[model samples]
Target chain A: MAVEILKENYAGKVLSMTIGVGDRAVTVGGATALPFHSFEGEVGNRPLIAYEVLDTVPEDPPASLQEELESVWDDPVKWAKYCQDEQGARAIALRLVSTDPDGQDASPESAAETVKKVLDAIDIPLVILGCFKEAKDGPVLKAAADAARGCNCLIGKAQEENYKTIAAAATANGHKLIAFSNLDFNLAKQINILLSQADFDINNIVTDPTASALGYGLEYTYSVIERIRAAGLMQNDAMMQPPMFLDLSSVVWKVKEVKASEEDLPEWGDRTERAVHWEAATATSLLMAGAEIMVMTSPRAIQTVEKTIDQLMA
Target chain B: MLLIGERINVITKAQRAAMEARDPKPIQEIAKAQVEAGATMLDINIGPAEDDGPQLMDWIVKTVQEVVQVPLCLDTTNLDAIRAGLKAHNNEWGKPMINSTSGETVRLNTFMPVAAEFQCDIIGLCLSGSGLPADANERCAIAVDIMGKAAEVGLPIENIHLDPLVLMLNGNQEQAMHCINAVEMFQTLNDPPMKTVVGLSNIANTAPMEMKGILTAVFYKMLVDAGLSGAIIDTLEKDFMEVVRTGDPASVYPAEHVEKTMKVMRGEIMYAHSFLEV
Candidate 1:
């Protein structure tokens, strides 16, 4: 008897969306089978990793995240340029953290200026993330989206509360919108449907179905991502077909394993290595769960993630 | 699951009486009830009681469509009756389906073009006349041939769903495993998997009444793992439909998800707040 491999012929493929313009532009999704099930179908693009940069000065972004880019930490443009030019970043995720109503409370105009400087300095793709505060997200994200016009960037995180204004901005600027739903499958689908109702085509969309840190309820996040992928591939669902965007570092860095100090807890191992491993492990787990793009902060973690991808995809 | 509810046929006592009287109420009630019970398609089979079978099939098709918005699966052995149902079909929902054809020479020659000409989907029974194949490999070959013939008539292979006939597992235990293998092999016939189904109630035809539901549901779950995408079953069986809904965990989840989903399957986790509520 011959042993046959269990391979699926997925009815639907993930929507392949192109980010950035010119030679360095990246295209993600287009797997007619499950992730890395190469015997059955083709995986069009490898997962993309974008180094995260903040518009506000980094008051504190974990000590492990700090040392990786100590030289470029002072300036957002320097940080974005350094990640693109020096680190060979295929994409840059510029988070407008200062525009939050409760944080630094910077005006939308200043955030847009930061966006313009980074857009002018980098040739790679950009994913502009809003501060996610309900009161100020509409104005700030609109300014950032307007600033990155014609760049073919991914502008997003349209939550239920502020999706209307963000959807308008993303469509008007001709960029993909990232709809965020808090770890619930129906809400993720509902928000995408909601975005489509606002006249944004469902194809020009990415989804963040709420990232959970590796140790803290990671299984729930894993299951949700799997459900999304299955609905798209096996079930031929359009609303669930967008490439998953795992915003890992924001949650991973704040977790116990990634932030606990070596001196504070010696048996937990080296603080820097542990944090890098935490980010890489969280990313790899989600990639297997069907993430197409991930936003991460540590260079060492990105290296490990690339290595893991190579090993699995090889 | 593309559940074609099998309870509307004149083979049942109430259905026969209603068809004999030319009354539309019973047919209409079954149509509305099946649709409400989560059936995507209803199979209309007008039995031999009526000499005006074609006209009655047309009436049944029209009556069902009036009550429900789902596509109808015209279920009859006679080509003319199938045509009448197809003629009366008002595709307010989508293209309707033909219950089936087989790799038998007469079937492939007659039914393939009817499906293509009408632009309707069909079920391809994986049989070539003598009987259900003794093994999975032979059944797969016949399914492939049926698909090829359907394609020759300009019917895209996807429009042809192959049903590797579900055999009675009471005395023929080996046939159960063969059906599972055939279902899995049907997927390899196309790049995106040719649709496949099991005539679910046929598996328990010889079993006792209480055992029928349990046996069919277990077999249905197994067939789903083997890539069965549709079924011809009693939609009134709420527990069976639930099995169909929750079938095939491997295709839908990671290992960790399977662990949690298994608990959901076993009723250990009732209010699972995840979007996995199929």
Candidate 2:
């Protein structure tokens, strides 16, 4: 008997959407087959990388990130500029952490100022993330969205509780919206259905099922993304076809394996190298599991993942 | 799962009347509603329309395609009617599917060439001219014949969908298991594995009216888990549609209903008049 290769014929393709404006715009998520299964169908665009730039300075930053970004920590514009210029970042994710009600409680007006300054400093695309506080995010993201209007930026994280105002702001300003959900396929799909019901163009939406670090429930996140992608490709589900977004930096940096000191655990290897490897491993695993847009910190980790993407795309 | 809506058939009173009157409102309304409710394809069954089958199929195909942008499955015993529907199809969304061809030599010889020429999908019924098969192995035997014909005509394996006919649960209980097993068997019969579809409601056809919904929904979950690809089902049933959308039948149906349905499926208990009560 002759050995024959079995290939799956997919019925659907992931909808590709472009963010940013002019020649610097980035398009993602148009895979007719599974992620990197290029022999089966067209894998549209390469997975994109966006460096995380925080609005507020952290009290206890990792040694590797602090060493690299210490000079630009206090200034959001300089931080974004350094990531864009020196780090060779393709895009920047401006996280409005100071707007958290439990933290600095920075007003929406101040968040808007930072957004405007970052937009002026970077030539690449921008992704405006919220403080993760449902109530505060509505106003802060709206202000930030207004400040970056017509920039074709990606603004997000419209959750189940506060999608109305954020979706409105993204729609009104001609920017794309990120629909965030917990680590469940149903919840992720429900958010997209809700946004569609609200008259938001389904093509302009990106799915963000919340991410977890490598050791901290990464498998659950991986399964959710895999299910979402299968629903889009195998089932031809219209609502689940949008590209997926993952915030690897926020979760990867907080894990114990990534932040532990070498003196505390001498057998675990060097602190800086271990942290970078942790971030890179989490990112590459999810990328294979089907992640199109990833927000990551640690310039070295970003570079490592970028190299891995090139190898996979090749 | 490719959810093919089963609402636009001539068996329904409104649909039959609309087809008789040549009215497009009632038919188009159901087509649009099914698409809105997450039906990727609609089955347009015009039952043995020996006389005006061709014209009726053409009109309905054009009518439905005008309003929505999903594929249509032209279902009838009339070959000319199937051809007319195919001719009238716009192909803006996708090619029209012929529902379907069976292992019977005449039907297979006639339709496989058309399916190959159009390069659209066609459902392969896993039965012979003698009637429905007795077991999964018998169904596979017939499927081999169908695949041979499809190959002779150069039909792409991906475009071929094998349907292991769903039997009623009230009496032919063992055949239900065979149907599910046949679906699993059809998947491995080809290199680029063949797709599978089922008339999902047939399993619950003779059940109590009140028990039909749970019966079909639970059976749908079983077929999906067994690797069945497409299902012709009532897409408007919210609970059943929930299972279709989320693929979590355990969450949508009641716990006892799911367990009872499983018992019947496994042949642990006979399907009876008081099946749900048991």
Candidate 3:
């Protein structure tokens, strides 16, 4: 049977770019189709997964993950290098966790230094993330954006309230911006619209539909991503068409299933195995739902996710 | 243009009987045949048949998708049935079409989001609370309104198919003409011409035998001229086949392929040429 190719030809195009540089650089591209369904439609590039590095030590990480990152977690640059050199990470996502208000209250200068250190150590595309807290992230991300100037890195987690400063910084520093929004598809679209209306070229924007862990509203995440992709293709909704980025590891790690001890959930089986599976499952699902780039942790879990993606693309 | 084969409706006795018996073989056969007949989609409707509409729609959609690569158009007024069909087939390409809706604000309010969520195309009928428009002007007005509403919800106009509600010859001889005129009007109004279609046999319903043939030909001719892309017509009819052949000026048959297929269909083409060489 001759299949009718459903090609989406639209007025606006989604911006695509690899966040990091050099050997670890992961190429991100956009096709107006669902993930890995080229025969049915068009998907220009396979989803890329980036391993995450924390600027400050995590309060409590699963034993399985701790075992992997124990040696280098103290230094953000070393952690970034470990992800790229040893774990074969396609990109490095440096989370400025120290800037969190309740955390170390690390100054903007410190965050800038961390950004410089990671950039110097790894040449792959870099995604410098702001601390989740809006007030603290404003200054920290500004400093980090300046330090990473002209490296062509992508910096983000720019929310509705703090987008002005972050977008200006990104515009000035020659970096891509990640427009973060709540779980709602419309809100994600609105944020993109807001940015573009402010003269921020949407082609440089990647949307982050705030991720939820496996078994924790993951279906909602899947639906949101799927909706965004459909809007881009079938509806040709310009504002919602940007390549989506999923913060896969942070969401997966924070879930109880990943952190719960063997005694806490006996039926869940081994904690480490379950935790890795949780991350893998969550990341895989997001990829299927049209996540172009993912920021993840756990080298073994990354391996599993990459394998799943290989099979899906195959 | 997406062809949603509207053959599974329980409005027909045979279809109702098939649904009542919980027998999906006939519906599945219809769906498969439509797909083979160049339909990129099949509309499954088991509306209020005492049988499980949702379950039947799901089964047929899945069964059809398993055999045919084309998508299914879930045609039912029942929301549950539509949801069921969506759940049963989860593939991206197999996305279902929510068969129809009128432009009434209340109806659009409910239907638009579902269409968006399911990522399906919708068929918009040109009618409002004033009922089916009596003339082409009113019909075109309703159609434009529906198109605007669809656009407002971010539905690309190409994804919307406008049905101008063809009327039977027995009721009004001019109904077909009105529908054709509306199609032309809609074509001009739409940015990228929206797909226009109708039930081809509707114009002939209860009409005199001679009148049916003449009206069908006239209706089809007007539709063709007005840029009607597709319709739910009887594929078995010689007249319909002729219309399909001449529908578009650009659809010239590939002579070799046509001859081969026609010969095979007639059992004249053989596969044993080498073996029979003496």
Q: How many residue pairs clash in each candidate?
A: 0, 0, 8
Off by over 4 Å in 3: A1-14, A22-24, B1-278
lDDT of 1 by residue, A93-156 (tens): 9999888877789999999999999999999999999888876888988998899888888987
User: lDDT tens digits, residues A1-314, model 3?
Assistant: 99886654544334566555555556676674567766655566778887899987878778878988889999888898888888877788899888887878889998999899889998788888988887777788889999999887888889989998899999999889989988876568767877877789888899999898889999999988886776666555666678889998768888888888889789989988988889888888888788888988888888998998888778
lDDT per residue (tens digit) for residues B1-278 in model 3: 44556666778787778777767677667767766666666667767434476777777677667666776666777777777887887466655667677878887877766776766777788889887789889988888888787767777777677889887644353465678788888888756777787767787776546445444555665577778876765443455455466753123333353343233222232211110110
Candidate 2 lDDT, A1-314, residue by residue in tens: 99888999998899999998988899998899999999899988998989999998976898878877899989889899999889888899999999999989999999999999999988899999999999999999999999999998999889989999999999889999999988867568778878888889889999998888899999999988997788788767777789999999879998888788989998999999999999999999999889999999989999999999999999
- Identify the leading candidate in terms of TM-score: 2
User: Model 2, range B1-278, lDDT digits (tens) per residue?
Assistant: 78899999999999999999999999999999999999999999999999899999999999999999999999999989998999999898887899999999999999999999888999999879897799999999988898899889998867888999888876577788899899999989987778999999998875768878878888888888899889998888888888777777677877887887787687654454345542
For B1-278, candidate 1 gives per-residue lDDT tens digits of 68889888878899989877878899989889998988888988775424687888887888789889999988777788888888899988878898779889898899888999898999898889877699889899898888788778899888988898887754344577788888998899899888987798887766557546556766777677777899988888876776666764333334465554334333232211232322
Winning model by lDDT: 2
Relative to the unseen true structure, what is the Cα RMSD of model 2?
Answer: 20.0
Per-candidate interface C-alpha RMSD? Answer: 13.7, 16.2, 29.2
Worst 10 residues of 2 chain B by lDDT: B269-278
